[model samples]
Target: MPFKRPLLSSHTTDDSESQSDSSHGGPSKRRRVSSPRNIEKDKTVLVYILQAKIDPEMMSELAMLVENYKVERGNESLEGPTSVSELNLELTGDVEKADVIVTATNMRQRLERHVEWRIAKTKAIVTPLWLQDSVKSGRPVPYGSYIAVHHLEDETSRSHDTVQDASSGSPSNMPSEAEKQSCWQTEPTELIDTTEVELLSHTAKYSCLRPSPLVCPNQSLVKEIDVIRQGRNVEGEERSMLSYSRAISVIKAYPHVITKHNIRDLHELPFLGVKILSMIEEFLKTGQITEAQRMLADPRFQSLSAFITIHGIGPHTARRLYDLGLRTLEELERYYEVKPGVSDEETMPLLDAEASANTEAAGEQSIKIGLALRHDLGQTIPRDEVEEINGTIMRELGHIQKGCKSVIAGGYRRGKPQSNDVDIVITHTDWNLGSQKVKGLCRKLVQRLHEQGLVTHVMHLSGFHEHNVLRTHHWDSLEKALTVFVSRHNSSRQNVYRRVDLIFTAPEVFWTAVVGWTGSTMFERDLRLWAKQQKGMKFDSSGISRRHDSKLYHPRTERDVFKVLGLVYIHPTLRNADA
Candidate 1:
């Protein structure tokens, strides 16, 4: 029996079922939330729960679509289970606050019976997996309607640092219809009325792209960190100045930074904020922050990241796991598995198992990879060498086509000067002869580099066709000559464990392409919101388009893209993830 959740805002519903459950030892109580807006007045609620693997590589891009869509409609979209006992406690109350309910059909068997909706009309949008289940059950998903879409892949282009467009539109507040479609549009495929249950594997375009690990303990941390580094340039200034990256210098040493002083003294230190203070204090007393503690106890992280940390799981995914109620990798391993491989069903806390297994696996992978590549990609290669390799790759392609233009984006373009991977965006007048031919060009280039003994363990991707909107690809072995990954020593002298992403775009969306690829994802997200909320347009890493009419848009330059979005151009450094 589930409990009822309190959602006292726009609508109301009775939860006698939860009350009954509570009378039998539960925590079901009625309460309400005061929201500033009453979006439930006469609209529907669409709740998307990711029940499958989520490709982190595409997270920033998907966020663009979600955030932009909401702004375009001036609507409020709420998520989070808010509580367990969800059906008896929360759902009944939450649904009453809306005129309609829309959920991904994936949980048809798992959640449908647990949380029953009695509304006259309920809508279910089936993904490929959900569709298969529906067909197997001989069900029509008797709801408002079912729409199956490849949400992540349809138009996942990179975002520019600022304004994200500037490919075909002028610096104005409004983007023409043409500009809108260039960014996003529906590409309907054959009806997914399949009756098969065969498992299909999917991959994100940039599944190999990963988050940077935390600051190294062996290395000194940055000091002279500028506080409030970025702000809108007053009329006297341009767009908000970007955040400071490289610290001027560590002029002072603060000892035992964590325990040297209390929150008060820490506040007096450079760059410490209330939030950061809380995190530090929590860690000092209990050896962890609330989030970290919660994360450690969750099953997913314990099983996944904790163990996967050996493979470089970052803070972003750790938090996402915590949010999913998985406190440890152990829990993740033991809990809700779509595939039944691990068998330890004694029903202990779900997250603990995940954490243990995750830790063990991470340790093993680290030992294996570190030993293999210790002599190779050990210390950072000279920035010059990193650039030289990329330059060589691009120049080789250019030799294949005289006027082809190739740009290295991602952290390299962001001025990291040092990076774990290299991403190249190409465009040319003869698109087919130049950019469109990158897949073959990359193979020849990498093979040639290998023959010269200047290239080591390598992976290359072309035509990254994304399948499922949720979990996509594990790019480790999905490339040309992936066997190089087996190297015991990842040497960067010539080419040690290097990840490269190559993408080709039409000349029409060339600028958009550049903007999308040249991004601090955070800055890109902000610019996208600016366009949708202020300019009545949808902005993505791929293209800019009209919101009302759902049209494609293009801007020729980065400045024009921002101008059209009613914003000044933002620099890459200013794009902080926390922002």
Candidate 2:
């Protein structure tokens, strides 16, 4: 739908048996004509899917791609509304007639099927460089069940013919003699360059959602990165082939897409997608992704990845262990399992198995938080940490519940070295089971922990800002909150000093607040942009409500919350400190 042309293809048949077949003129070929006016701006519908919701880089890529397509085709084509369902209805008054669903990775299976079975009669394109593998491998497009692939083969053949005729100082099949003498011909159909933008990537790449799934949000990039990574630890000749990794893969998937690439003269390679080409006649000046894939083969990162997989480790911990000359699970085992009689550390300090076991427990949970954040907050946290930085009264003072509904978030989630404190969110199943006794369970947990001394201190619950935030709160009574204090004792001679926050959440606001409180400040700000600026919805630390009507929208799960925001769901572990 980001295309400037209406008809997908136009072809000419050889005249050998045309008259005998009774076909209509054997389908005369034609070319697209340019218009000097803005075309896409006048469309009634637009469906814009975001691959990296909070990525400055990827969003910039998408905008450029859209604008460029307009300039090249000399037409303004509308995709559809931002919402997918609305685009499907074919409502007469709907301003969106086009469906431009975007994603950070490959098109998801469900959304693809939805478009395939139900929304078949529409236009859609899923961007993001990560989609190269899926699109090339014949996986369904995330936009819908079937793709309206713009046919450039016929155009290619036409262009070839036209060039051949011109080389001889004349177009052989001109409409008339006057047209034949013309030095210039009309615009020939060609394959419009597809857009491939990445939302953002600092040291780590983030999926559109904070952390939901293990797969990359951009399917193509994921596959390509995997292809590159898997090809690592190679022999002499294989290592030499590394430099051409990205370009070779991109060209392979789309041979004619890069009709030309002068790799030798290029310095840094950049992938502009369709946007830059609109502005510059030669956006793809070189046949490279532009940045020059230098760090494509990172043996160190792969090794760190291996080290962090141990039981009690996080990224930071693993990194430190690596620095200390212990780089893998095997090395750690070697150190701890030295011969029984060896005085290597007596000579070496004793390596107690139990101490390591406790660390392993922490590391195992850290992995969970990481996986949970894959789509919820796409970057991985340290080996034993979650990703966010919030510590409410309940989580900081929470009891080790058998089933108290617990999730660790914040710096602790990201596996930081000595966090100031831990943030935990809790709610009893019967928090609102139609009786005060049932609801009292939440408050009771705080009391039980306080009595047990796991909590060292407690902060009085603060009232809501008593000021405007998203214009949704009533009377400013602190958004219906609750908290409690507790203290913990240490076996050492020194007193312990750390605070924990345990928040009792109502069913209606549980998921939203759980995720909100579990986020990094930056990532949460991005969520705000999606809510207030993009989706016309309102999200607060307390709950998610409708923008126009101030209707409180209670999501049954975190996935639903992401769905309404027009984003892919991320998991916990991947949320990282950025979330």
Candidate 3:
């Protein structure tokens, strides 16, 4: 026979009419009225429980406790009944409209999949213990102690063991037990194998030797390291920044999902130091890096990062501005203006008058223009806008000279949805033209664009004269102009300034220039590194040269360049080495 549960009821109140009838001493009548306990039930704290991995008996008890629970308000009002708080706890179904979510420790990742979990920043996600304790104590407890961590079976350990067993036949294929032990000094549960996993087919050291896609499986970990890398760059720690960048590139190129079980694969890669490895382990354990979080929350670092984004502002200038007590772009703008009776010593105590004067004279106009149009220039250029801009440039180029070809490089060619700037490489099929002809074509294109109200400002123009060409040694010495551009047909009805770089290359190195300009920085860096170290060739945007004899090799196509370097041609979309 099944047992029947008893129903709980609140105290009833007597109606005023019933009291008046009893006072009249006639045949008295009684009526029931709603009580404060029933009124308190109207206002409830909604809690949704994720039942995975929780004991059935415990869950049953929790449901009963929640149904009978009342949050004690403590005797603040000594003269009246204490305020009552009721619980509207649910053990099953969706978490919509829930103020709190209680789940098992191992179910954090599952809880994160809920849309409400991410959108509601104030919603509390706690362990079952929090709810149990809250009911026992008659109030919601502090969430700090109950934030969940995974306590399920360690899949990483099982996967690592499987790979180790599979590679046992070839001892040299696996890292020695001592090396694996040394990689992590914590308890056995925290140990991470520092050798390459057999499951991963590729373990190349150079980024050019592997494929790195834009969507990385380890993006969360990559983001934390990038934050720290940016902080180092802003602080002018070049060595540290390069270290983080190398680690980032390696991580991005890694094809497998990064987990504690397979983290040892990163150890096989070059450029990742013990510090970076420790941070990776920390993130896998806690979903955050302490150093990265601290830097993100630092006010001074925030100010410096903002300043570095301004045109013509580098790390040193950003630091100097910070030293002068300037914490924002507006403050820096005010400082740049000429003020009467404001001596250099009074305004910039950190620098001498001569140094201040030299800094002011250098790039003053560029800085002023950058500040004036910061908002317009800072907006990202969508793919459609980039295409429209490219069309405009092509039209102007056709008017200036016939039979010219062009390609939009940079992130656009790499298939990015949006880009910070537009880089266009133009060249003619005719190879008989002299270098002066190419320079003249570039000059005419800029002039035409300016006359058409497209080129609003010219930040730089190079390689147009013989002296400028002789002064530079690289292929980047191609005729080029960096200008601020605005389309005459802006559908947004606003003057949106865009940074446009126009590079005019000779027909011989046009493909090479395209490859150079369309790059993820690490991919290009590794390509050059591979050429110099392995092929004994110097590679750049201009062309590749045999370092042994200074003989130049002109690759007519992008594939020819890769073939000469002995690298598998990677599509631009797969060249995202997140440096």
| lDDT agreement with native, every candidate | 0.37, 0.37, 0.64
> Lowest summed-lDDT stretch of 10 residues in model 1?
200-209
* TM-score between model 3 and native: 0.60
Estimated TM-score per prediction?
0.36, 0.32, 0.60
Tens digits of lDDT, candidate 2, 1-579: 232222111111112224313442443233222433222212122334342332665555444544344343232112433311101101111213333334433333334443442342243433343123222322211221112222122232343243223222223332222211111111112222122112223212222332322222233333433333333412223443333232322222221222235332222222323422321223244323222243344555555666554323555665676778875555655554533212121100101122233444434433433222222223232323222222333354344332234455455543345444456654433323312222444334444544555432222332233234455555221122122122223245242333445555554455676668666553566577678877888775567767677666655455446666766544443344221
Off by over 4 Å in 3: 1-202, 338-362, 434-436, 464-477
148-169, model 1: which lDDT tens digit per residue?
A: 3222111111111011122112
Q: Candidate order by TM-score, highest to lowest?
A: 3, 1, 2
Quick one: best lDDT, which candidate?
A: 3
Model 2 residue 10 distance off true place after TM-score fit, in angstroms: 46
User: Model 2: residues >4 Å from true position, as ranges?
Assistant: 1-403, 414-418, 431-448, 462-490, 577-579
Q: How far is candidate 1 from the true structure (C-alpha RMSD, Å)?
A: 27.5
User: Candidate 3's error at 452, in angstroms?
Assistant: 1.1
